[model samples]
Each structure stands twice: as structure tokens, then as C-alpha cells.
Target: MSLINSLLLLFIAILISYLLVQLMQWSNLFDKWLDQISKKEDPSFGNDTEGLLEVVETLPQFTVSDISGQLIGIQELIDNKKTLLIFLNEECEFCGSNFEHFSQLINNYKGKKNIQVLFQSNQKETARNFYDVYDGKFSVHLYKKEVISEVGINFFPAYLIVDPTHSIDLITHNPIQVAHSLNFD
Candidate 1:
């Protein structure tokens, strides 16, 4: 009888623990806790800083076309100005969210900072779609994959700030990083 009572007690504890966990999950408390944990993690842990370092540390001169289908070189686009290069994917959910924040940033810094929106050369249709709806005064250009690869672009919604000397001063994975880099935060 004593052994049966001990087993019953253990079962109850386990059942209570299981239900508590389920309640937390059902209320999304577990997810919020996980999000807090993830937010505390080092940003670089998810970013391949090594990959960008291994690739071109400086912005390279590469040619891409503008909205009118006219070919333009990177040097010409930047034209000795410090530029913020934003590489966005039309299909990416994150990019769609970031676009609004970025548009506001670009509008605020219009002439003060040379901000350029880049799309993969292959994504002409997607680029055109973005261009059509985009009301920002910033120039939108298409970039070759090689150009971005040189800058160590491994993911969508990539960002880099190149100084007037063509040095890549900042490389980042998220919109917060962009805001921080631009000192808009």
C-alpha cells in the first residue's frame, strides 16, 4: 500500500507539471520567454562576420542597371559619397517589414546620406515591382550577385554602409543594426 501511494504521488506531480507547461504554451508565455532569451543572445552569433571579412572588406566597383534599364557602375552610383547599400528581397517577409522603416530613414537622410536600394540582377521583375510602389526619392538599382557576394551577402535583407573611400564600414543582418549604424536609433 505504501509503494502504491508513492507511485500515485509521483504520477500526480508529473501530471501537474505537464499541465502547467501546456498552460504556459497555450497562453504564449513560453514563446515570450524564448523570445526574451533569443534577444539577449549576441547579434554576431547568428551573423557570419567571418564570411564578410573573408570576402571583400571594401566596396567593389560593379555595374548594374537603374529602373530605366540603363547600365550604371557602382562608382558612378556612389560618386564619391558615403552610401548605405540595402539589399532587399521581394519575397522575404522580413524585407517587406523592414522596407517601411528603411523608407522613413532614407527620407529623413535623403541628401545627407547616399542611400541605394539594390536588387539581384536576376530579380528585375521583382525590382520593377518594388520601384513602382516605392515613393522614396532614393535611387533604386539592380546589382549582380557577384557584387553582393564580394560584400559577403549570405542572406536576404542584407545591409552595408560604405564610406566615401569605398571601405565597407558596416555589415549587418537586421533593420535594428541598420538604424544603429545610421545613428537613427
Candidate 2:
């Protein structure tokens, strides 16, 4: 009788332990799901997270058309110079506000480094007008609407620095920090 009671107690303890472990796992999964939902609701949620450049092993090659309808390859853009690639949306308010700052940065770096602005919009004329109005001093390109997805960018006003060796680095979302990262004023 004593031996049976001991075995029964041991069995109950093991079952309870298993239940607790499963409950903890389920709770953790629930918490993660909530976090994801909240992040999706917040536009700027993931902007502070580490960007793709930290994880990607290689930069993909791409070709885009400049404002003047010239076909420019990524390699040609970065040829023998450190290139600052600014991805913008003509419709985005934040992007619109930063146009002058970007133009100023490009002007400051003119003849020293390559600065290119890639507008991710379907309206080529709108992009051209924006560039013209701002007196943009950098090479301006109109990217295909799908280029954003192709490059894995989730936000506009994103910055990428391509070194002379063609290696790419992602600057943080802060414009001041991005300018500093490129050693620009």
C-alpha cells in the first residue's frame, strides 16, 4: 500500500510539471502575438530595429532609370566612390519635408561622393517635378513601384551607403545620424 501511494504521488507530480511547462509556452506565444499586433498598428515601430544590412550577406544587383531616362546600374552608381542612396516616396509627408535636407547634403558632398535619390513612385512626372523644385543636386532615379519590396525596405526616407567596394551599409532612420554616418554635415 505504501509503495503504491508513493508511485501515485510521483506520477501526479510529473503530470503537473508537464502541464505547467506547456502553460508557460502557450503564455509566451500569446505575448509574442500581442507584441506583433501592436507593432503593426504603430507605423514607426520597427524603424529603430536593426535593418537588413546587418543580416544580409550580399547586396543584390539592380538597374534603374534615371530622371533623364538613362539606364543606370548599381555598380555604375557606386563606381570608385562612396554612394549615399536615399529612398523616398513622393507622397510621404516625412519624405517631402526631408527633400531640402537631402538636397543640401548632396550639394555639400557634390564632386566628392556620389549621392543618388531613388523615388519609389509610379508618377514619374511628379518625381521629376519634386526634384526640379528642390533644385536637387544629386542623380535622381525613378524606381519601379516594386523596387521597395525587392530591396526589403518597409519604410521611406531610408538611407543606404554603398562603399567603393560595392558593400552596402544601412544608416539608422535619424537623418542627422545618417548624415553624420556618411561624414556629411
Candidate 3:
């Protein structure tokens, strides 16, 4: 084959390989890479990525005004109790399900002032409307879209569980699992 043709074929092969690598990563086939790292160790059965949806690398302490116009800080909320931080966008269907789950959790934790349901929203109007829907069940907060985007939460409805000491416990996509993990009672 000509040198130019050979070079072209090489470039196409490289491109295809790169795309396949990305696809594998996107599909979360990290097991193959993990296996290479450890041959003796068997993969953990609890290797589900769904649990990661509720996690925050470092639980940040910040003050945000609730829908009732009350200034609530993260530390203060979790000073002596757990907190459920829900990131919601009004248009997201997942968020609607999350809201219902939040209500169930609230019912479970009824009259327990320790558990605070905090909200972070992309749009103030949508946030306000969401607050209206919940109707004081949760301490909803509104934030700028860029703020949430900056936090690197690509998912629409992200849930984070913060312990009593204001430390992250788990991040999971399953709201039911989140409620169970937190032991909302």
C-alpha cells in the first residue's frame, strides 16, 4: 500500500479505538480496569453506581434562604441531626418522583425537627413553585443555575445524605435506598 494510504488507515484505526474507549467508560465498565489493578481481589457485589447519586465529595457549609425567607445554614441544619439535600429542576420528571419520595420521608420523620429537607434549584421561579407544591414540608432554597452547574452535578435530580456532624454518608440515585440508608424514622 502507498505510505499516504497506510497513514490514513492508521488514523482511522486510532479514532475507532478512542471512540470505543469512551463508549466503555460511558457504560461504566470500570470493572475491566479494576480487574487489571487487582487480580487477587474479587469485585465487590455492592458495586452499584446507583448509590453514587446521593454523594457529595466534600459537604460544603453555606447559608441559603428558605422559601419561607428564613436564613438556614448547612451546619446549623445538621448541627444535631441528618439532612437530606435534594437538587431539583422544575421541568425534570425525576424531580417530581423525588418530591414524592421527599414527602414520604418527611412523613416518616414527622415532627422530628432534626431532619431538614433542603432544596437547591436552577431557577428561582421554578424553585419557588416547587416550594409551593411541598407547602412548608421542606426547607426549600433557591440558587442560580450556574451555581449548581458549577458543582458538577450533571444529573437532574441528585440526592446527598449528610450526617449529623455535617459529613457526607452516601450519594445514591435510588430515592428509596436513600431513605432506607438514612433510616428516616
Which candidate leads the pack in TM-score?
1
List model 3 lDDT by residue over 1-185, tens digit each.
Answer: 69999999999999999999998875564464334324422234221443233234567656666665677666766676776777777655456766687568656643454434434543666667766776755666755455454444555566666677666665544566565565542
Worst 10 residues of 1 by lDDT: 45-54
Give a tens-digit lDDT track for model 2, residues 1-185. 99999999999999999999999987886586446435533334333434332333234678878887888887788776777878878655457656567556545543465678887647678769867876774578877776666566675567777677766665433455465566631
- Compared with the true structure, all predictions reach lDDT values of 0.70, 0.66, 0.59
What's the best-to-worst order under TM-score? 1, 2, 3
Once fitted onto the true fold, the runs of candidate 3 whose alpha carbons sit more than 4 angstroms away are 1-55, 68-71, 105-122, 145-152
Better of 1 and 2 by TM-score: 1
Clashing pairs in 1: none
Q: Residue 38 of model 3: what lDDT? A: 46
Say which prediction, candidate 2 or candidate 3, comes out ahead on lDDT.
2
Kindly report which residue stretches of model 1 are placed more than 4 angstroms away from their true locations once superposed.
1-55, 105-111, 183-185
Candidate 1, residues 61-178, lDDT tens digits: the string is: 7888987789988888778877788888765545766677766655554336677889888888888778777754557888777875676676567677787778887776556556
lDDT for model 3: 0.59
Worst 10 residues of 3 by lDDT: 38-47
Winning model by lDDT? 1
